[model samples]
Target: MNFFGTIFSYIRETYVDRLSYFPSNIKISLMIILFCAIAIVELYIYIIFRRVIKANQNKQTKYWKERIGNMLASVVVYDESENTAEIAVHFYDKLKKLPLKNSTVNQILTSEIITYHKNFTGKIPEVLALLYAKLKLDKRSKKKIDSKHWETKIEGIREANEMGISEMAEEIIKYTDDENGLLRMEAQAAYLKLSNKDPFHFLDRAQERILDWHQLVLFEIITKNKKLTIPSFSKWLRSPNDTVVMFCLKLIDHFMQFDAAEEVQRLLKHHNTRIVKKSIEIIGKLELEELEKHMFEIYFDHTDEIKLEILNSLGKISSGKYADFLSSRIHSNDSKIKRAALYAIKRDADHGEARLLEIYHHTSPENQALITHVLDNRIKQ
Candidate 1:
């Protein structure tokens, strides 16, 4: 019995010692199973916690937005001169009682106030601006400008500009060089909005490419002034950055800055196709009749698109030998070139009808159809 008991003890110690005698592969598999079970439970708990937090935040936002909306409506909807004093006192007392520590609520209130300003302009915007000052929202927005995240900083810049916080202009200008394109664009626009004395100071030094959409936004803002100190875009025509030069050319043409005509003629010889195209557009629009010879000289050295544009520009300058020049292209195989040449002939040349008839008699059926279409369109017009 003692021997049997000793053997039983040895067996228990060697094989039944809580999985110690298991194969290595089985031991590792068991560990992995145990780890997966724990991880699944933890992930399940985390998901529940997130859902609870989101729901609580939604409730808090709803409560705060309601309280702030009523206060804002009173200030925006009330008459500026008469009811403002009573509303101001009521608003301040209520605002002081409300908890301003909730950043979500602050953002909600800021958006509501900005919405009021966006929709209405006169005395209401002024009232909202005063209310914004009284609530000290500007401090909150200004704080976001220094945030580590680029999007947060851009939002702060936007809110600052929307509220007419003129002091933020210099701070906003610092972001114009941000590597992110959207951030740079928003910062530049905000700079223009906040800086009244020098609204265009950013454009003057901006070496970045001003895209077409960016130009449209800037143009709309600059033209809104009842009495604007319009700067001479000629200053930027010589900028080494081609995009800046292109933007200045567009501004000059849109604003009809005729003084830049001499500077514009110089860009016709520029190597960039886009710049040359825009220069041609400006010349055509402004009727710069003196550059006809230069236009003809550059015609053969450019693409078909540029050639078509040259014909269009030549059509605008009727005083020179552009008619005889266009006559040479009337037989080109490229249909667009031939069409443009015909259009230029009719518009620029005095004996263009005789030229069209002569071409029709000797040309192919396709060419005859093109000339006949041009003549018919002229009579219809």
Candidate 2:
């Protein structure tokens, strides 16, 4: 019996030992509860600590930003940008170096200065800002870049000068030796736009490179005062060069006397199609009486080219008397010349519409259709 009690006591102690240390079911439950409680406390503490750290960092950054902004007020004008102002001030104080470079930094600084002036709330400051921009654009420390570059920069300076931009014309003239015609032309146009003046008088020798459009505008300005400068007119009008002659023809047809018109008319007989077309254009611009004489003189001598030119001039002249002359062309064996005459007749054929209607009904279906189409298109417009 003592031996049985001893065995039972040994079994009970082993069971208790297992529960306390090695883990029975009850011990496993207790361990799991205790581990979950500790994990919950640790996670809560981590969250609180992270929030505290973020708040402290933000506070420190804000404090530093404000402090530097207050300090920068001594040297530069303070505007909005509260945070950036603080940071910029701190960067300036910590570094002995400036925020901008000597060459390009002035540009940055100039824009900043303009902003500062604008923030001050007055036109005076705005004007000063403009002057600042002009000053920085013009102050060339070295001439490493070509004249074109300098001229372009100088153009900005002159532009800021407004009515005074003409002074920059002298600077632009310095670049005339430039091989680049485009740059030279830009300078010429810029000079014209700025000064409300003409450089063409001075550019007489350089007119070969002057484009037609630019020359026309500049010509208008130079002649704006009605100062009667005939020598320039003669050089432009009688020049053997086609472009110059075309420009002259355009100007003279619009503004010159009949004498100039007569000159272009004489050149129509010249072999060049250019001169012929130009004269046809001039005839459109002339009075009907003036046109009748010229068209009559050229009428009988009809090369296919001259025939077309006369037809074009007659359409512009539009006299009923010539409707008969044109009617004869309808009978011509040349189909194109007949069609051309039909167009002229259809245009001036007020009393002759009966003749056209008669011709339409009697003529071939193709001729009838062609004439009918031309009449429809012309009359509808």
Query: Which candidate comes out best when scored by TM-score?
Result: 1
Candidate lDDT (C-alpha), each = 0.81, 0.55
Candidate 1 lDDT tens digits, 205-243? 786777788878877877785445888888788888787
Worst 10 residues of 1 by lDDT: 81-90
Off by over 4 Å in 2: 1-164, 170-181, 195-235, 250-260, 269-271, 286-288, 295-309, 331-336, 349-369, 377-381
In model 2, state the lDDT of residue 251: 62
lDDT of 2 by residue, 1-381 (tens): 699999878756755655577647766776686688789999999999999999987775566445433433332443434454453444344422433334344444443444444455533343333444344333431121223365545434333333233445555554433456555555555454444344544344344545676667656754573543433343455555555566666666656446665566566665666556666666755644465666657666647766766776676667766776776776677777777777766666465466677777777777777678656754541
Residue pairs in collision within model 2 = none
